[model samples]
Structures are given as C-alpha cells and as structure tokens.
Target: MKKWLIFSILIMFGIFNLNEPVLAEAGAADLTSEAAVLMDTQSGAILFGKNEEVKMYPASLTKIATAIYAIEKGNLDDQVIVSKKVFDIDGTRVYLNPGEQVTLKKLIQGMLINSGNDAAMAIAIHLDGTMEKYSQHVNEFLESEIGVKATHFVNPHGLFDEDHYTTAKDLGIILNYAMKNEDFREIFGTKQMKWDGESWDTTLLSHHRMLKGEIPYPGVTGGKTGFVDQSKQTLATTAENGPLKLTAILLKSEYKKKIYDDTIKLFDYGFSNFKSSQVKKGEVFTSGKRQFTYSADTFLTDPIDEGNRTVDSNGVLNIENREGKVIQTVELKPIIKKKLEVKNTAQKAEQSGVLSLNSIVGGILLLFAVGVLVLNRKQKRNRRYRSR
Candidate 1:
C-alpha cells in the first residue's frame, strides 16, 4: 500500500509538470552587438530589442534610403550624366568616367548591389542637382514620407559623417518601409548583377553573406551591409517563415561573424516564440459598453503562449507579451451605437403601429355585432306583436 501511494504521487507530479506552460527563451542577453532590434514586418511589432534607440553610425546603410527615394522620385529610364565630382568621392565605386552617361535605374542598382559610393553620388546629383540639396530633400522625404524621426543623413553614401547617424530602431523602420515598394524589393534581394559601366566592368556582388547564401540561413529574403571605423559593422536583414516576416538590425559589432550570429539568433527567437495573428475586417471587440472594430484586415504578432490583449475605453488595442509589456498598439474605430438605437426605435414603431391597427379593427367588429344583435331583437318583438 505504501509503494502504491508513492507511485501515484509521482505520476500526478509528472502530469502536472507536463501540463505547465513553458516560457520563451530570451535572446537579447545573448547578443554581443552594441545595439540590435527584431521587428515583425506584418504588424510592425518589436519582438526583441537591446539598446535599439541608441544613435550610431549607419555606414553604407544610407544607400538603402537613397535607393528607395530615387525609385519613387526619379524616372528609371532617364539618362543621368556622371559628373567629375563622383570620381573624387572615396570608398567603393563603379569607376564612372567624367562624362559617362547612365540610366538612373542602373546607378541605383550599382549603389545597392555593390555599395558603390560613386553611383550614389551620381544619383544624388541627378535628382536634386547638388549633394547639399540632395541631403536636404532626402531628409524631408524621410520625415514626411517614411515617417522616420531619429535618422539624419548628410550624404548619400554613408561614408563617415558625424552628423549622419541613425538608431537601430530607426533603421528597422526604414528597411520595413523600403521593402513595401516592389522595385526596391527586387533590387535589394539581388545577389549579383552584370555591370556594364563606362570604366569598370565586372559582376557586382552583394555584401550581405546570408543573402548571398554564404551563411546559409533559411528564409533570408534581403539584406544590406555597412562598415566604417566609427560605425564598426552594421547589418540589416529580412526574412520570412510561413506567415511571420521579420526584420533584424544589428549595429556596432566588432566582427562580421558576430553580427551574422546575432542575426541568426534574433531570427530563431522570433520564429520559435512568436506567431502571426490576423484580425479580420469588421471584427468587433468589446470593452465594457464600447464596441470597436478594424476597417481592414490586419496582421499582428504575439507570443505563442501567455499573451494578453486588452482594449481601453478609447478603443486602443494593446497587445502585451507574457511580461505584460505592450509590444504593439492600434487605434480601433468605435462602432456607432446610434445606428443600433435607430434600428431598435424603428422596430418598436412598427410593433406599435401593428398593435394600434389590431385594436381599431376589434372595436369596429364589436360595434357591428352589437348593432346586429339589437336589430335582431327588435325584429323578433315586431314579429310577436304581429302574431298577437
């Protein structure tokens, strides 16, 4: 009896342990980079962040903004004349001659695929006529169009200007915005392209190792790499697995391998712990007496377990992680109560009208019956009198 009781207790304890929810493994503490961020592209949720808001040099990542801006603002087919100024710019170059004429589209391709500073200078000059003007216009465009607040660029090529700095969170925002444009996506994902420039003729290759398959990470869609003495090494990577799309930004890493490792870690954490949840169009959520709904279908990321959703009285939906930190917030439109009230009022009026009509009909029938009965009685009396 004693042995059986002990065995039963052990079995019950094992069952309880199995039923308990497992917490997600935290990855931020394991990263070696100075600043990093992981964002869900579908819902714009930050899954993991470490020093993400600290301003640091972006290095060559500035080309990403320049490329997207040019794609949206400049015509692809327009012939852009290379100036002598581009030849003097230091760093990577497509080696353009003084008067070499190239299409705006090709220059953008060279700048992004090969990280060519010369190509970036040419695009900047062609679009806004001078580097200073280009900087001013691009800054305005970033703030007004892309909605970035913490990023500022002094030049097109992120060569090393103290004034040109952006945080990891801001870079993540910029990359997410750029990935929305189809043309930018195509160029950004290109591993290698044939370059038929005026001076330099070679196959331009992407510097991002994972994107080029050198690191061999699954679901890597696009990437951008940057490096300078001050900025160290910075990387932007985008990946997708089923419904979950992720963007990772790593800044100020000392070595190339470490940044890539950090990126893989970030991706693994995101894919393993989080899931994409869809809120359908017109899906209604209630908070006390107020009802709110989304006008269009929306996707959001949440933890696999222990996640909570709460709506405030103002109809703001807050998605919280297991720790109760709000990872994302969305403003939901209030469902108008007046329409329902009007519908109920109309129903009540129709019912009242029906009742009134029934009462009137019943009264008329009763009066008719009374009149007939009286007439019948009078006739009977008259007949009796005649008989007598």
Candidate 2:
C-alpha cells in the first residue's frame, strides 16, 4: 500500500507540472545582424534586443532624421537654390546643377525617395545655412526632442563621416518619435514620387525593398535602408498588425539580405507572441491609500499570457508577463475623484466637531468656576459688613 501510494503521488506531481503553461526559453535565435532590436512603437517596449545599444554607423538612415527636421524647420513652399557644394556630394544624386531651384518639399521627396545626396545637401543648407551648422542642429534635435543619446551626425547626406554613428535602439526611438508627425509619416511611407528637378525628371522610387513592395511584408507601413563601407547594411522598418504597431531596427549586418531576414524575425516574434493589451480610460487601480484611474486608454504591447498589471502610487503601471518579467511601464495621469475629496472633508469635519465640543465644555466649566468664586467673595464681604 505504501509503494502504490508513493507512485500515485509522483504521477499527480507530473500532471500538475504539465498543466502549467511553461514559458518558452527567453530570447530569439538565428538573427544574423550584429545589432538588432524589436520595439513596440505604441508602448516603446523592447521585445527583443541584441547589442541594441552598441554604436554603429547609420549611413543613409541619417536621412530619416534630416527629412523630418527639414519638414519641421524649413517652409515647404520656399524655393531652395542648389549650391555648387551640393553637386560635389558623393554617392547617388538627383543631378542638381549649381543654380537649380527646387521647392523644399520636392527636395525632401527626392532625398528620401531617391536617396539623393544633392537634395539632402540643398535642404540642409537652406535650413541651417551651412553643413556644419546643420550637423550641430540635427544632433541637438535628436537628443532633446527624440530623446536619443547614442546618435551623432556630421552631415545631412549620410556620407561616411567617421563621427556619424547611431545605435539600433536609438534608431527605433527616433523613428517612433518621427512617426508622430503627420507630414513626416506621409513622406516616410511614400514608395515613389515624381521628380521635376532641372537635371533629373524621372520618377523617384524608395530604395527600401519592403516599402516598395519588391519584398513583400505583411502590414508594412514604412521603411528606410542604409549602407556604407563603415556601416555595412542597416535597415529600419515599421509595421502594424491589428492594434499593435512595431518598429524593427537592424544595424551592421554582414550581408544585405541578412538585414531583411532579421527584420522579419523580429516582426514575427512581436506579432505572434505579443498583443496590444489596453486598460480602458477611467479604469481604477489602487496603490497604497490613493486610487488612480487611467487618464487615457493605456495601450501596451504585452505577452498573450500577461496576467495582471499593477499601478503604483507614482502613477506608473507595470505590465508583467506570466513569468513575472515586467515587459512595459506606462505613466498614467492621476485622477482626483470628487467623492474621495468629499469623504476626506467629512472626516476632517468630524474631527473638528470633536475639538469644538471639547473647547465649549472647557470654556463653560471655567466660566462657572469664576462665577462661583465671585459669589463667594460677595457673601464674605456682606458677612463682614453685617457683623460690623
């Protein structure tokens, strides 16, 4: 009986372990890029990372920053005169002549869609007055506005400047911030555009294979590709599946196709294993004595098995997976409920009433004592007068 009972207990333990959903061994495999990152654009969660913070050359991916900066700072309707220095820029060109005049908007399209170094130069010169000034301005903008620390730029056209470097993680940060601008989003996702420049009149096509549909990727919204001897092959791609928006960054890949392959793997991992989980606006969560409600729908990319999220008194929500790894942090706006305020006031009033009653009783007792003493003194004085 003892042997049979022990065997049954062992069998029950095995069944219990099998019933539990075991978390797959963490991290992705077989990515070829030297550095890669997959990020949820909505929640800014790094789903997968491999040397993402290590600095690498950005190459023409620098144009991603230049395009948005020009759109924000320079007037699109303003005509930019192509300087002679623009013609001297190395790599692909829109064949701009020294005195050619092009609108700032058209130049942005050429630079982004056709990867035109000439157009990039004209835009930079027009915006910041000189390449040196443009480089400084863009670097500051990247740090201050986009919150990217691991990035630096020396030129608007991503020529191989030794100082020009960025990390895959930083690129994802910049791209996510840039996508918020309506004008930038339109230009970034554009697959092709017509060029009416003085030297080149052909249609400009985006060099990014995924964006151009040369390489089909599901739900591909936008992409940018970069290459140089120093940077090797770098690619940034953004895609949306259902409510989840994802950005994938790959840098310093040895082979060109390897970048695309890495991006696909990142996307698959993000979309398949994770989902956009939302805590609706006004959903209440308690932290310590304070209760906080979601100011807006807190949309987060979470693992499918993410059990419950907790909000702290600091108004930060922690989304944790089943394995208890915190995957996302959301800063929520703290709400003040009128009922709670009223309750606090009522409690204060009750305490105030107790204090007031104590004061009244003490004042009454002191007044009665003083009256009794005065009366006694009057009686004593009357007795003395009558006796005399």
Candidate 3:
C-alpha cells in the first residue's frame, strides 16, 4: 500500500514527462533527399550531411563554376560573336542566333539566371576557344583554385555526360568560392533580368522556387536549380540570418518538394543548434609550459564546448562533439616565450637552419669586405713604394 501510494505521487509530479520528450540532436533532421549537405559558409564546417561525399551528377550546378571562371578570366564588355555551335547544344537556352553579337556580361547573366545552355556554350567557346579545352581548363581551375576534389566536367552547359559527376560537398565548395566574388554573387542571387538578345528578347526569370518567392523561405540570398533524366532534381541555396550564413546542397532528390523541405530542415537545424563563435586572433592557449596563439581570426559555427576543444603541439585547434567526432580544426600560431621556447625546439630546428644559412652568408660577405680593404691597402703601398 505504501509503494502504490509512492508511485501515484511520482506520476502526479510528472517525473516521467513522456508527453514532452526531448528529441536527440542527431536524429533531428528528417531529410528525404538521397544526398544532401548543409555547411557554414564562413567557416567551411559541415552543419548537417547525408552521404555528402558520395559522387553524383551535379547537372546545372556546374554553371556556378563556369560563371565565376568567366567573371574572373573574361573581359565582360567584350562582344562574343554567336557561333553556330551554340545552337547545336541541348537543353534550356537563350536562343542565340548565329552571327548575332552579345556582351560577355549579358551572357553570364543569362546563363546563371535563366539556365541558358547556349549562353554557357558561347562563353566557353569564346573564352577557351573550344568546348574540349573549356572542360579541361575549368576542371583544373576548380581543383587548383577552389580545392574541390570529387568533381569533373565534360561540358560547360552540364549536359548529361557519363563522366561528369560531383558530390554534394564539392558543390557546396564551389558555391562557397563563387559567392565570394561580388560579380558572381550579384548575378547568382538575381531573380530577374531583362534580355534584349537578337533571337530571344525577354525577361529571364530564375527557376529557383525559393529565390523567386514561389516557395516562401526567409533569408534566401542565392540559389541554383537543375534537373536531368539521369541526375534527377538537384538544388543549391544560400541564406543568411543574423551573423550566420549557410549553404545547402541537395542532389538526386526524386521529389522536387523533398529537396526544398530538406533544405529548410537543414537550415533550421543549423540556426537552432549551432552558433557563431570565434577564437580571437592572438588568444593564448597554454599546454604545459608552452603557449600557442591563433594566427588569424577564425570564425566557427559549431556548438561551443571549451572543455572539448584541444590544441596540439603543432598548433591545431580541434573541436569535438559529445560523440567524439571532430567538428572543426583550426590552424594556430605558436607563441614562443623565453621559458616556453625550448619545448618546441625540435619544431624550430627548421627556423634555426634558415638562420644558419643567413649567418653563413653574412660571414662570407664580411670576408669579401676584408679582402677588398686588404687589396686597397696593398695598392696604396705599391704606389707609395713607386713614389719613393
């Protein structure tokens, strides 16, 4: 009777609280896309990912790279004579007629805003001379400049090619790089633009639903959408709320709405769970007698837990979560003091070698100066002897 009375009292106190169960963080994202990635654009940290590294068709997202490449490499004012080859390309187009002329800037705007295949081909052939050469140059540029690994391009227009493929993470990498350019960012985020082409003179409208307001989402900064029979529906979006800037990439989604839904959930997860944080430039961290300072101001978006963060002897700051997975790794500069300097003597040996080289060069220079002085003195004595 006492035990039963105690149980009843515990229930009344709401000790169980089964109706208001707390959801776990890992399972919070309910995504249906085959592959997706959400990243903090400022920090390059992955906020949420599902098969992010898995290789898949990027479709028109390839133009994000092409647009930036052209903006940086081509003279925007130069008139490109429309070639017959542009009309030969497949998929969406701005309907450029052969022998018609258009500015590089206008073609870029049309290509990005309207998903114009002909514009892409025109830019490629005009800038790089050939479609085959354009692919090689762009692939190399993406790998060398943007640091993308799991992507390859066969055509600038992103026509279905078996060899052309990229991952969600790679697309995020390309978008992050492209967004840094003011020119590319302006066109990338543009929803509508007037086109006075010789063949098709109409306003080019963005196909991205969120960017166009077809799908209402707050803080929609820029977006790109693509679909092909082999690639399915692929989307890329960028948004900023307060100090947080996020980029979400969805690939191979069977349902178009699923991509948008997954994007919203990803953004919500990032904004709700993560926050902007910084380890100020020159903030000292002590390990034993040695001290290390962050070389530059680094911004972070992961959940802050100072205790879970560690600095190694090499001056790398590693932040880990409760599950022990590494969330971010930042490079730091080692601040050597009189007492703490000896701890990293082995690492400083390279610097010492450089000093030694400088010392050797200085000694040789001094010897050369002394030789010059001695020669001058000898010459003076010879002249004096001749005078006597």
Which candidate number maximizes lDDT? 1
Query: Highest TM-score: which candidate?
Result: 1
- In angstroms, what RMSD does candidate 1 have relative to the true structure? 6.6
Off by over 4 Å in 3: 1-29, 278-290, 304-307, 340-388
lDDT tens digits by residue: candidate 2, 1-388: 9998987898777843544443323434587788888888877887778888998888888898998888878898998888888867889888999988888988888888888888999999989888889989999998988799889999987788779888888988888888888888888899988777676678888889989888789899988888888888889899999899999989888988878887887887778778886679888777777777777776677787555578865779887766676778877777676555788899999999999999999999999999999999999999999999
What does candidate 2 score on TM?
A: 0.78
Model 1, C-alpha of 314: deviation from truth (Å): 2.0
- Among all windows of 10 consecutive residues in model 3, the one with the lowest summed lDDT is 19-28
Native-to-model Cα distance after best TM-score fit, residue 388 in candidate 1, in Å:
32
lDDT of 1 by residue, 1-388 (tens): 9998987898877843655433323566778889999999878899888999999999998998999999999999999988889979998888888789999999999999899999999999999998889999999999999888999998999999889999999888888889889999999999999998767789999999999999999999999999999999999999999989999999999999999999999998888878997899999988778789997888878888888888986778999989898888888999886445788889999999999999999999999999999999999999999999
Give RMSD to native, each candidate: 6.6, 8.6, 12.5
Ranking by TM-score: 1, 3, 2
lDDT of 3: 0.85
Model 3 reaches what TM-score against the true structure?
Answer: 0.79
lDDT of each: 0.90, 0.84, 0.85
TM per candidate:
0.83, 0.78, 0.79
